[model samples]
Target: MRVDDFDFELPPERIALRPASPRDAARMLVADTRGLRDRVVRELPEILRAGDCLVFNDTRVIPARLEGRRGDAAISATLHKREGPRRWRAFIRNARRLRDGDTIAFGGEVQAVAADRAADGSFALDFAGDEPVEILLERAGSMPLPPYIASRRPTDARDARDYQTMFAREAGAVAAPTAALHFTPELMAELDAAGIAHETLTLHVGAGTFLPVKAEDTDDHVMHAEWGRIDAATADRLNAVRRDGGRVIAVGTTSLRLIESAAGADDVIRPFEGDTDIFITPGYRFRGVDGLMTNFHLPRSTLFMLVSALMGLERMQAVYAHAIAGDYRFYSYGDASLLLPA
Candidate 1:
């Protein structure tokens, strides 16, 4: 389909610069077989069935954004994928100032040598140190805030905590699973008490998630691969949920994509490890997840396409129009939507 079909006009003020004061205070737009309902994150337990299972992405966001200099010219790089203990695949600004052998000195101890420029214009940067790269990033890197938010303001200490979910543990992601940001300990406790089970998996979200679909048609768009993992135990449990007639609710697109990647044609989920570049579009059949809880997405983005696939394109367009006119927030730090397509 033409990419233009997914396009819409969004008012600039609709973008959320800060998250809700209490995470669970964020609005949630619930669209199910019945119809669209405006709700809040705290009311999740009321909307979901007791047998539903919410799968969350526990990948922690790293301070991947870096500012450095090579012979007086400044360079900015956001590390997307970890190629080695010291090597990272990064998207660079002022990339024209760098060559394969060039070394950039990030003040106060972090330095990396640029090597291998990919056709997409990203670079492989190998840090110069014996210490773990995470520690080096601690000294020199800032939170990799989404450009939509960062362009409006600057990242600060508050964002360090705000951008991470309570379930955060394993670290690797350059981007936060925004939908999960609406979840809180209190909300989880309520869900647990309500007998709604939840699980965690990992998907190191990359810089590619922020990239726009420049392709004229959906067939021409290529998704960037992101590393993810699902253990045997999680797979078996998810399968059991389906067998017992429970809904498998994916907490975010990251979890949804990884689960779909590991699912069989018969709808059985299996263990998965490694990269997935699954580009979900309309007409694609979903095998693994029964429902999705995700943030409002950008116009013409792959994420919007994913939701459109779950719910019909016309339905999602109506959903968005309602969200906009109702004053619901948009983007990574925005409000969320619970989509259950029958």
Candidate 2:
């Protein structure tokens, strides 16, 4: 299909600069077999069935955005993927001034040597230190906010806390699974009392999530690989849930993609590890997840295409129209939607 098929106009003011206070106070647009319903995130326990399971991405957002200099020229890089213990692939801002073997010095004695520039303009940055690269990032890096939000305002201390979910533990992701940002301890307690089970997996969200679909056709767009993991125990439990007639609802696209990646033709999920560049579009069959809870996405984005695949393209178009008319927030720091297809 033509990429233009997914396009829509969004007002600039609709973008959320800050997350809702108390997290669970954010608005939620629920789209199901019945119809669209406007609700708040705190009411999730009431909205979802008791037998449903919410799979969350527990991958923590690393401080991946770095500002440094090489010979008086300022350069910015956002580390997207880990190539090795000390090597990372990063998208650089000042590529015109950089070349292979140039050492860029970041503050606090952190520096990296750039090499092997890819056709996509990313570089393999090998850090110059014996200390762990995580430590180097701690001294020199800031949270990698989505370009839409960062373009409007600067990243700050507040994002350090706000961007991460309560389930964040294993660190690697450059971007937070924003849908889970609405979840709080109180909300979890309510969900527990309501008998709605929750599980976690890891998918280190990369900066590629922020990239736009420049392709004229969906077939031409290539998704960037992101590392993810699902162990045997989790897979067994998820299969058991479905085996017992429970629904497996993924809390974010990250979780959904991994689940679908691990599922067989028979719809049984299995253990998985390593990189996944799964590009979900309309007409795709969803085998693993019954429903999805995700943030409002950008126009013509792969995420929108993924949602269109879950629900019908016509239905999601209507869903977005409803969301926009209702003044729902958009993007990473924005409001969320629950999509359950009939």
Candidate 3:
């Protein structure tokens, strides 16, 4: 499909600078088979069935944004993926200033030797230090906020907590699964009391998630690979839920994509772990996820295309139109959407 099919005009004011105080206080727009409905994040449990299960991404957001220098030039690097115990693939700001075998000094904390630049412009940096890379990062790294937000304002201490979801535990992702950001402990308890089951899988969201679909057509877009995992116990339970007439509700596109990747042609989910470059588009069939809870996405973004695939493109267009008019927030720190397709 032409990428233009997913384009829509969004007012600048629709972008949210901060999330709602309680997280669950954020507004939610539900797009289902019946029609669109205005709601709040706190009311999620009331919208679904008792037997339905919510699949969550447990991958934690790492403090991946780093400010450093190579000799006299200032350099900025956002670690996208861990290559090894001491090496990482990073997207550098002043990449032109770097060369293979140059040392980029992070600070007094540590230094990394740049080598092996990827075709995407990201470079592999192997750290030289006795301390673990995580420790060095703790001293030198800042939250890797999305460009839409970071360009507006600098990342502050608040982002250290705000950008991380309550479900964040396993540390690997450079970007948080923004859709899961709306969830709160209270909301989870409510879902439990309401007989709504929830399970977790890990999908280390990469900074590549921020890359634009520069391709004119969906067919030409190259989706970046992201690491993900699903354990056998969780997989068996999820398959059982579906077999017992329940629905699988993916809390974010990350979990949705990973689950779909792990599902067989028979629609039975299995244990899986590794990289997934599953770029969801309108024509792709969704076998694992029955519903999705996600954030408002950018115009002509891969995320928007995924939602359009779930609930027809025309319907999502209308849903987004309503959301914008209703003053609902947008982007990584925006309002939420609960999408249910028939």
TM-score of each model, in listed order = 0.99, 0.99, 0.98
What's the alpha carbon RMSD for model 3?
A: 0.9
Q: List runs of model 3 lying over 4 Å from the truth.
A: none
Regions more than 4 Å wrong, model 1: none
* Alpha-carbon local distance difference test for all models: 0.95, 0.95, 0.92
Candidate 1: clashing pairs of residues = none
Model 2: CA > 4 A from native: none
TM-score of 3: 0.98
User: Where does candidate 1 have its weakest 10-residue lDDT segment?
Assistant: 107-116
Tens-digit lDDT track of model 1 for 183-272: 988999999999899999999999999999999999999999999999999999999998988999999999999999999898899999
Backbone clash pairs for candidate 3 read none
Model 3, 247: alpha-carbon shift in Å?
Answer: 0.6
